[model samples]
Target: MSELFPVQASEASRPLASRLAPKALTDFSGQEQLLGPGKLLRRLVEADRVASAVFFGPPGTGKTALARFIAAKSGAEIVELNAVTAGVADLKKALEAARYRLGQSGTKTLLLVDEIHHFNRTQQDVLLPAVERGDVILIGMTTENPSFYVNAALLSRSTAFEFLPLPEAALERILDRALGDAGAGLGGAQAALDPEARAHLVRMSGGDARRLLNALELAVLTTPVEMDGRRHITLAVAEESIQKRSLRYDKSSDDHYDHISAFIKSMRGSDPDAALYWMAKMLAAGEDPRFVARRVLICAAEDVGNADFRALLIANAAFQAVESLGMPEARIPLAQAVTYVAAAPKSNAAYLAVDAALREAEQGPPREVPLHLRDANLDAKSRGHGQGYKYAHDFPGHFVFQEYMPQPVRFYLPDGQGDEARIAKRLAVLEALKSEPKAGRKGEP
Candidate 1:
C-alpha cells in the first residue's frame, strides 16, 4: 500500500504540505505549553473539567485542532460552525441536538464556533443561556479580541485560551514533519528547497504554519520540473512569492501586535539597524504614521523618560506634524521621531510609577479631599470657602510646600531621566526651603 500510494490517507498527502496534518492530539506540533505535562488544558482534559473556552489566535495556529482534542477527551460530540455562514436558527437546532445526546447517551455536546466575533449580538445572545446552564460546551475560536467582539454574558461563562503564533523552532519542526509524513510524501517528487528558499518561506509566512504549508505546496505545484534538480526553488522564486503578498501592518489583527512587539524589542535591544528594519516594515505594511507617532510619544515618556526630554518633544511634534502635513511628506518627521525615540535613553520609571500608584489605589483607602482643597465653586461651598488657603505665592517664589495629597499619597516620583535631573534638583531645593523654619514656611508633610 505504501509503495502504491507514495503517500498515506488521501491523495492530498501527496503534497509536501498536506502530508503533515496531525490527525490526533499526540501528533500535533507546536503549543507545547498547552500540551506539556502539568499544563492547564492537559489537566482539564484528563480530569473531565475541560471548561467551555475561547481559542484565540492568529490564522492556522491550531484552534480547531485543540477544540477537537477537547471534545474527543470529554466524551463529547463536536459540532463545528462557522459564524459567518451559520445563522441563529442553525445554532438553536445544533445546541438542542447536542443537549439531547448529552442527556440520553452521556455524550456532552461541544459546539465549536469559528470566528465567534463575526456573529452579531443576536446570534451570541442565543448561545448565552445554554452556555450559562452548561447545556452545551461552547468553544469559540476568533482571530479578534474577544473582549471587544464577544458578548459579555457569554464571555463570562467561558474561559479564554490564548494561542500565539508558532515560534521558529516549532515552524521548523512542522517543515521537517511535512518532509517525513508518508501521507504527504510529495517528498518523493523531484523537488528540493534550497537554504534561501527555506529561510524565505519561514520569514514570509510570518509564523503562520498554515501559510508555510500552503506556500510550500503552491511553490512546488506551480514550478515545472527542470533537469537541474527538479526546479528547486531558488531565492529568486521565493522572492517573487513574497513580493506578491499583500501588506497589512495596521490591520489590528495579530500582525499589528507582532510587528509592534518586534519593533519595540529591537529598539530596546539598542539595534538601530533592526529598528529601521521594523520601521520600514511598518511603513511598507501601511501602519498609521499617527499611531506610530503616538507610540513614539508614549515610548519617550515611558522608556526614554528624562534621559532625553527632546525625544518626547520630537514624538509629540511628529504626531502634530503627521496630522497637519499628512502622508508622503509626513513620513519624514515620523521616521525622524522613531529613530530619535529609539536612540534616546530608556527608563521604565514613569511606567512603573503609574503601575505602582494604581496598585496602591486598589489597596489603600480612598482618602477624602482635604477641606481647604475642596471645590468652592458651587454656592453649597459657602461654608469656609478657601478659608485656610494661605497666599504663599505672595510671600515667596509663587510656590508653597503643602500637603495637598490626602492619605499622604505620592504619585510623581521623578527619576534621573534626561532633563528630569534638573527638575528633580529644583524640587529638592523647594523641598529644602519648606523645611527651613527661618524661611517662615513649615514643610508640609
Candidate 2:
C-alpha cells in the first residue's frame, strides 16, 4: 500500500482551518496545560519520544492537530488513517510498511488514527501486537470517553490524555492570529470584525477554534467590501452567517450548573416566565432531557413540598412523559413541568425537616423506639414491647397521643404556609386533647 494518500488541494484553495493549522508547537493556540513547560506530552514531544497514546476529548479541541504536531516533531515517516474509513486491511498494510522501513533504514513510522472510537473491539485488537512490541508508534484520536469505547487490552497498552475545550481568551488569540497572518489568513482581504461581531463569533464558537475560523471565513467571504476598500463584519452579518443565537451553555463547563441553578431558583421564586425561558434555552442547546427532568422532579419535592403535594405527582408524570418522548417533543413535557412547578404553592418545610432530622441523627446516639410503638408480633410481646400500647382507633376521634421515640426530637416545624396551615391546625387540636387535665388521661399511663 502507498505510505500516504495523494494531496487533494493546492495551498491557496485549502479551507481556513487547514491553511492556518500550526506548523510548530510554539504556534499552537490552545492546550497550554499539555504543551506548557515540564508537561508530560511536551517532554515526550520535545525529546522526540513518540509514545503509543490516545488523545480523547470533545470535538475541535486539538486532538488531530496535536497528533500532527507530534508526527512533525518526531521526524518520523508518518501515515494518517481515519478510523471511520480505514480497516484491519489498511492497518496490516501500514504495519507491513512500518516494519520494512524500520528494518531497511531504521526509520520509525507513526500511524496517526483519527476517530479511533469508531473501530470496534475486533478491529482495535489488531494493532495490539505492533503497539505492545514498540514496532509502530500509534497516535489515536477520539471525541468519546476512551474507558467505555476502547478495548481494555489496547487501552492498557496506550496512555490516554484528555484535551479540554479551548478557553475564550485562547480562542480570541487564535482569531487574532488568523486575521493577521498574511499568507494563510484574511489579512490580504483587509477584513475587520466589529467589536460586537467579534464578541458574537467568540461566544457562538463555544471554544472551538475550527468553528470560530469557519464562522469568520463565512462572514468575510460573503460580505461585500465597503467604499473604504475594507470588508467589515458587523454584528448583523455575523448573526446571519452563524444563523443561530449563542446560548453559551456547555454541558461540560460551569455554564451547565449555573443555568440549572437559575432554572431551579426561578421555579422556587414562582416566576413561570423565567423558569420556562431557562428550560427552553437548555432544551434548545441539546441538553440531556433526562437531566432536565431530574432537576424538575427535585424542585417539585424541595420547593413545592407538602404545600402542594400534587406538584410531585405532576412533575413525576412529566418526567415519565419526557423519557417516553425524546428531544423536540420532550421539550413540551419539560416546559409543562417547569410551569406547573413554578405556579404551584411553594414551601420548603419538608426539605428543611429532613435535613434537620439528619443532622440530629448524626449528632447523637441512636434512640430506642418507645415500648408502645414497638413491634407487637408474637415474639416481640415476650420482651414487653407492646406493654402500654393503646390503639388510637379504640379512642375518641381515633387520635390518642402516645410516645414514639425514647428521646424527644422535634425536627418538623411546618411554616403554616398553604396546605401546611391545615396540618398545623389539626396538630394543635390533638395537643390540646392530650394535655387537658385528668379527663384527657383516659388512655395515658
Candidate 3:
C-alpha cells in the first residue's frame, strides 16, 4: 500500500509540491471555511472522530494532502487506492486488509481513494459495507460533484466537504514559506523573485498551490546563478514557467453549465461587457459556436422582444452566419448579436403574453372563435359564420371594434419600452374608440 505521507526523500528527486505537503493543520494553507478554528472537520480531525467523507473540488486544491494530514494527526494507518487504476479486486483486497487490521489489532485504517468518482456504481458498493461497519474510515476524493457522480446511497452515508481554490493571499503565504524553507524548498538555491514575477506565477497558477510551486521550481532552477550566488526570477522567466492561465472549465461538467448560465444572465442583466467576456471564454475553451448563437437568438426574442425587434433578426442572422462560416469567423457575428441583444431596450411583454395565454389555454376552459371572425369563404351566409363582421378597411384607421374571441381575455400588457410604447398608445386609442357610441360611428350602415 502507498504511504499516507511519503518519507522525506532527496529534494533533487521529489517534486516541490510533494516534498512540501502539509504535515499538520497549522501547516495547511487555504480552506479556512473547513479548517478554521471550531470548524466541524477540524474538531473531528483533532478528536480522531473522522468518519467516511468525500473531499470534492477542482484539481490541485489539496484534497489528497488534507487526507494525509488527517491520517498523520489521528495516527490512523492510511491505504491509498486510485480509482483510475485500482479495480473492484483492488478495492476488495484493501477492504479485507482493513477488516483484518481492525479485528486483529484494533488498528483503524483510513482508505484514501483518489478520483473515487471514476469507480462505477457496483465498484463503489464494495466499499459500502466496510464503511458502514466502521472497519475503515473512507476518504473518497473527487474533482466531480459527488451528488452527480457518486451513488445516492454512498453519498448519503458520507459528509461532503468542498475545497475551493486557494485565494491570492493564501498562495502568497505558501510561496513565501516555500522560498524561505531550507529543508524541503528552494531556499538552498537562494532564488530572489521579483514582485511582478511573483504576481505572474500566482495569477497564472489559477489559485492552485501545486501549480504555483511547480512554476516557481521551474523558474528558480532554470535561471542562471548570478555573481552574488542568487538566482533572480524576472517576470519574463515567470511567464515562461507558467505560460498560460489555467482556466477551471470542463466542457461536460459543472463549468459548462455555470459558464453558459453566466453568459445568458449577463445579457439579460444588460451587461454587454460581461456577456462578451463569457462568450470569449467559451469560444476559447472550444465551445460550439452554434450553441452560443442559439442562446443569443433566444435572449433576443425573450428579453428584447418588441422593444427592439431588430435584435431577433440580428440574432437569427448570427445563427445563420455561424452555420455557414463556422468557428474563427463565426465568433464575430455571435459577438455582434450578443452585444446587440444586451444593449437593446429590454422588454419581455411578448414572451410573458404568450406564456400567460398558453397557461389559460391549457388550464382554463377552451373558448371557440367568435362567429364574426370565423372563415367567410366557407358557407358564409348559410351559418352566419361571417355575419356582422365590420370591414375595418372600409372605415377610418383600417381598424374597428369587433369581437375576436368568444370569451374576451386580456393577456398582452406592453411595458412601453422602445417600439412597444407606440403599440401601447395605439391600443389605448382603440380602447377609446370601443367606448364611442354606435350612432357617431363612421361607415356604419
lDDT of 3 at 83: 88
Clashing pairs in 1: 8-183, 13-184, 19-184, 303-347, 306-417, 306-418, 307-417, 307-418
lDDT ranking from best candidate downward: 3, 2, 1
Assess every candidate by TM-score: 0.69, 0.70, 0.91
Positional deviation of residue 20's Cα in model 3 after best superposition, in angstroms: 0.7
The candidate that achieves the highest lDDT relative to the unseen native structure:
3
* Tens digit of per-residue lDDT, candidate 3, span 1-445: 4543346667679999988999888888899999999999889988889899999998888899999888777667779888898888888888998899999999899899999989998998998889889999899999889888889888888999999999999999899989998998888999999999999999888879999999999999999999999999999999999998767777887789889999999999999999999999999988999989999999999999999999999999999999999989998999899999999999999999999999999988889878888898986889888888888786666767777776777999999999999888978877777877752255322
Which runs in model 1 stand beyond 4 Å of their true positions?
Answer: 1-19, 37-51, 68-77, 100-108, 145-148, 151-159, 228-231, 242-282, 298-309, 345-417, 423-445
* lDDT of the candidates, in the order given: 0.74, 0.84, 0.89
Model 3: colliding residue pairs: none
Better of 2 and 3 by TM-score: 3
Candidate 2, superposed: residue stretches over 4 Å from native: 1-7, 245-282, 285-308, 317-333, 339-392, 397-445
TM match of model 2 to true structure: 0.70
lDDT by residue (42-90, candidate 1, tens digit) is: 6886687887899887777778767766666666676778888888888
User: Compared with the true structure, what per-residue lDDT tens digits does model 2 show for residues 185-273?
Assistant: 98888888999999999888887888888889999899898999999999999998777745667786556877899999999999999
Give the backbone clash total of model 3.
Answer: 0
Q: What overall lDDT, based on C-alpha atoms, would model 2 receive against the true structure?
A: 0.84
RMSD of each: 7.4, 6.7, 3.0
Instruction: Pick out the ten consecutive residues of candidate 3 with the lowest summed lDDT.
Output: 436-445
Q: Which pairs of residues have clashing backbones in candidate 2?
A: none
